[model samples]
Target: MEVVVSQTAFNRIRCCVFDAYGTLFDVHSAVGVYREELGDRADQVSQLWRTKQLEYTWLRSLMKKHADFWKVTREALEYAFTVAGVTNPELFEKLMEAYLKLECYPDVRATLLTLKEKNFKTAILSNGSPMMLDSAVKNSQLYSLLDAILSVENVGVFKPHPSVYRLAEKEFDLYPNQILFLSSNAWDVCGAAAYGLKVAWVNRFQQPPENLPFQADVEIQSLNELPELLNIK
Candidate 1:
């Protein structure tokens, strides 16, 4: 909703790290892929499943009991189905597989190429497990443009964990101030900002931040405006 960084600050960023899932790929709308599978209850089932999946991730991380994203995704699906009173295990598996085949956001590939042409190092810092991210990246064919696809799996944690933010900075050997971390999840943007990296909150839904004490350097509705914010042109 507000711009916190100056043109000078944006220009200093040498690498642009992004959050996967909702940031680059439309993970939340994965329900559309399962709508036909669910028949009449399609929309409700899909929404419930996605909501529970993210809740499970946060709960599991807080308990310090780790399950990779895929495992948690399945567990959440099962819980959601049980809550929704659905009985088909076959349909559940089919829906989860659809996640493996998620399409990138319309502006993603073009934006990545634009950043690359500007000579900025680009990578993904995700809560996704190594195999989960690898499968998604490989399947989407966007891995070629990425310099690194770092995940929290190596640290057995999730985003908002300061350590995960540090891991990305270390991997690129860039100063925290030199990296511009972008995420659609407000908490993740807050975390990266707290960790001292310049941050951009991709408020794709035009929602407010989660009332966090920290703020993003810039907040844009989509990646389409990112190059302009960073003065890439």
Candidate 2:
């Protein structure tokens, strides 16, 4: 993989901050753990759960009716199960437990460890509640690789909010521009950019941006391609 960036842009990043769930971790794998419960409709159930989880957060955040990330996640699961014509609460709990144990992407541990070896600061700022983020990081074996695991719970809001970005800034004691903010979610990339971070959109799905008012500073498909983007070996 190759990344083309001007020398000036390459020189500016000292720290790398990642969005936890879809960026480093594979949310889909969590669905597979519960495939037996969902029968043949596991794929649809998983997709809907993810989609609704995000939608619930955005809507609740906008309406000022903020529920913590855990509640929203559970609600999304409930809705997904209902939509899939399933009615097993115990099965759903098992699925949620599996979600906490979602695996990291194939390249994630290696890339992150490489970044650490190169002495670049690393952290995760996620929409996940503190408890959820902690479990996810621990399960993925990323706890030591990351310097900090930040959650929006401190602010009672979600990503795309400037305050959430501030959590990263405050943790590293650096300005937003000094941090390389990466997310699989386009709106997050846009929001971080607007907040003055140099953004990287990990376009794992190869989809176009969702009409955000701003664009990412860089775009790449995988963490395997990331080191080259920042001129790391």
Candidate 3:
């Protein structure tokens, strides 16, 4: 699947920031928890839920209507259920709660620990609300590993917005070039790279190259390989 392709080395990167959802936590796992009740439409609902969530964010940004990730997520799930013609209050609430404690990917902990040990600042810059980000990080036992958990809500907008990217700069007081942004979302990679951060596209699912103005500085299929690319042994 053309997994590993290295371009630039560490190059004075001080902080390694990550995208939270698909990049570290398994977003689809939210639906996985209810697969039995969801039946044959489990995959469809999950896929639609993610798609709608992102679409709502972008749409809200363009429309100048801001809603936190939690609300956006719930609305997205509601839309998915409506489309699937399924209605179950208990299952719905459970699915929403599942996201707060989404299953983390296996490679995440070790990667963060390795970066922490190497003395590199690690953080999550996500479209998630502060509470959502905190829950996921703490639930995954990764809160202690991070130097910062930056949320777009602080800026009152979703990502790909120029203001959203500036949070990292303000938080770390580091120049854009000094930070390396990693995201499984190709569009997010484009956004951060366009905003001038050194970016590594964590292409977890071997998705095709994004048709966007900017591309990743490095690409890897797994987060486990990030340490190697940064020249850590």
Candidate 4:
């Protein structure tokens, strides 16, 4: 399906903000490094690790107890290890290191470059800590293509939170409708939409639409379609 931005909303977009993990980077990639060690359980471990990591973020946000993404990530990894019955300390360290350099999705660099060439302000809005984001972006060679790398470290909360969504408006000095927020996470898309941003849900995994109060203005299967969706050409 084509992007569905209305003319009015389309003209209001001054900046494009993206969620880092799962959207741009392959969060499951870390497990690929130890495919042999994980055997048949690699996928399970990755899924559980990611699920718990996000769960911790939401739980902490609601409880008003915030921790950086790194801590939450490590804690989630430990839980995944226990649940999956993987018990190598060395493998744990390796997995954490791999996460620092997660592979960027194939279409990310070209899409971001297209946006940059079009002079659209592009930024990363993520739950990653500053250090984590720095390493991932630099490692993926995406640092120069972006205008900003925003982290929840500044806000002490994870996504689906209105405050996290507000960081884009605060950083760019633009209203929510003037920013186009993209995320692979449906709940995040809902949160940004609810907060008044023009949103595009990058349904990379072909997941079902979320049953939330707000919905994204557009949905696409990959970043390759983004520039066209925004009429960047």
* lDDT by residue for model 1 (158-206), tens: 7788989998789999889899999998888888988999899999888
Q: What lDDT score belongs to each candidate, Candidate 1 first?
A: 0.85, 0.87, 0.91, 0.91
Instruction: Give me the displacement of residue 54 in model 1, in angstroms.
Output: 2.0
In the range 1-233, model 4's lDDT, one tens digit per residue, is 33566555577688889999999999999999888899999999999999999999999999989999999999999999999999999999999999999999999999989988888899999999999999999999998899999998888888888888899999999988889999999999999999999999999988988777799998989999877777775
* Model 2, position 43: C-alpha lDDT score: 91
Q: How accurate is candidate 1 locally (lDDT)?
A: 0.85
**How big is the RMSD of model 3?**
1.5
The worst-scoring run of ten residues by lDDT in candidate 1 lies at: 28-37
Q: lDDT (0-100) at residue 187 of candidate 2?
A: 80
Report how far off residue 32 is in candidate 4 (Å).
Answer: 1.1
Candidate 1: clashing residue pairs, number? 0
lDDT tens digits by residue: candidate 3, 102-175: 99999999999999999999999999999999899989999889999999988898999988889998999999
TM-score per model over all chains: 0.95, 0.95, 0.96, 0.96
**Candidate 2 lDDT score relative to the true structure:** 0.87
